[model samples]
Target: MSHHIVLRVVAKLLIPLILLFALYVQFHGDFGPGGGFQAGVIFAAALILYALVFGLDSARRVISPDLLRVLMASGVLLYGGVGVASLLLGGHFLDYSVLASDPVAGQHLGILLVELGVGITVTSTMLSLFYGFAGRGGDG
Candidate 1:
């Protein structure tokens, strides 16, 4: 296969595995040191690498700037929403016990939502940075 074709094929094959590993890190964070932040960076790095191998325009087409902005904002909102929910339930901010009737369930839900938020923010930020750098003629 041609060079471009080979790069595309490799990106296609590797991206999914990278995402899977990110998910694993996010889910197993409680049992280990890595968490949503790490997972998000890993996920974003994979996409950035793909862009580096391909082209900025191609990466932009796949993940639009508008979408990335939204994803980043949504992540912060999700995290804040969890805290607000906790406050509404008469608990300290991020106590997580207010998430559900059962405190443990609330904790689980809080962790999941927070992790998701972190992932979204991290991915979008990294992608946006990549776009900025690549657009400035770094990926020629």
Candidate 2:
């Protein structure tokens, strides 16, 4: 097959698997080697791969820089909000015990929220970086 044909085929086959692996990393983080940051990078890489083979314009349509900025800020806010909530509830920063009546359950919840924030921040940062490089005609 020609290079374009091969890339198209490979992208078609690989994207779903990449997304699945990212999800696995996001959810199975507590029990395995993967974690939020890794998962976010994995997810962003998959999208970046699409942009590499397809076009930056197409990728931008899917994930615009403005939206990415909001996402990045939202992630930070989420993490900070959790800490503030903990403090308001009469605990130190990120003290999960104040989040719920049951400390262990609160811990799980806190970890989940923090992991989600980390994942969002990581993914958006990487995507933005990819856009910066690729949009500058680095690939050419």
Candidate 3:
């Protein structure tokens, strides 16, 4: 991989674009088709490309397994927290109508938060999977 200078350069150029596109998908999801799952996969793909071009060790340094674990837990907490908050606000679980004074605004906010949590969880999970499998360093 180190010898493939052209490949490396192309990857360097492409990774940021991939990441930006993932962000676009993530943010525009509520209004359009793309969303957390798609964005997460796209984000992971960029990092996977980085790992393939740079090395697993480099990718690990960029996002350690310990951090990934924390992110996984945090994402779940975020998703669940929204539900609990809505409940505490006198609405049923996941009732976004109570999330804000304006129901429409609350709906938007809830969707945004829920989607963000999903994105975080999925991205970290996928990265963890890649690290676990790729780090094995065996053909099996």
Candidate 4:
């Protein structure tokens, strides 16, 4: 990969667009054809493409394993926190209606937060898995 000049150049141009598209999928999911799962996979795939082109060390440096672990935990907490918030507001578990004074507003807010959490967790988990597997391969 280090020697693949064309690949390196193309990757440099494409990676940002890939990341941007992942973000678009994540945010637009509420209204359209994508969601946390799809967005997360795309996000992880972009990072992986970076790893494949620039080396795992570079990718790890860009997004550390330690940070990934923290993100994984935080994402779960974020999702759970939304549920707890709803409960505190006198709603049922995982209920979004009480999150805001207006039920519709609350539902929208809760769904967005929940989806963001899912996206983070999925992306981190996939990337972590990729790193684990990549680490086990030959030193070639």
List clashing residue pairs in candidate 2. none
- Screening candidate 1 with a backbone cut-off below 3 angstroms (N, C-alpha, C), the clashing residue pairs are none
lDDT tens string, model 2, 19-93? 899989998998898888999999999998888777788878888999999998998899999999999999999
TM-score of each: 0.88, 0.93, 0.96, 0.96
lDDT (0 to 1) per candidate: 0.87, 0.88, 0.92, 0.92
lDDT score at residue 135, model 4, on the 0-100 scale = 75
State, as a TM-score between 0 and 1, how close model 4 is to the true structure. Answer: 0.96
Candidate 1 lDDT over 72-118, as tens digits, reads: 99999999988988999899999998889999988998998999899
lDDT per residue as tens, model 3, 1-140: 67999999999999999999999999999888999889989999999999999988888899999999999888889999999999999999999999999999999999999988899999999999998899887621
Alpha carbon lDDT of residue 25, candidate 4?
96
Better model by TM-score: candidate 1 vs candidate 3: 3
lDDT of 1 at 51: 76
**Runs of candidate 2 exceeding 4 Å displacement:** 1-3, 138-140
RMSD of 4: 1.1
- What's the residue-level lDDT of 77 in candidate 2? 90
Candidate 1, residue 59: CA error in Å?
1.1
- Positional deviation of 5 in candidate 2, in angstroms? 1.4
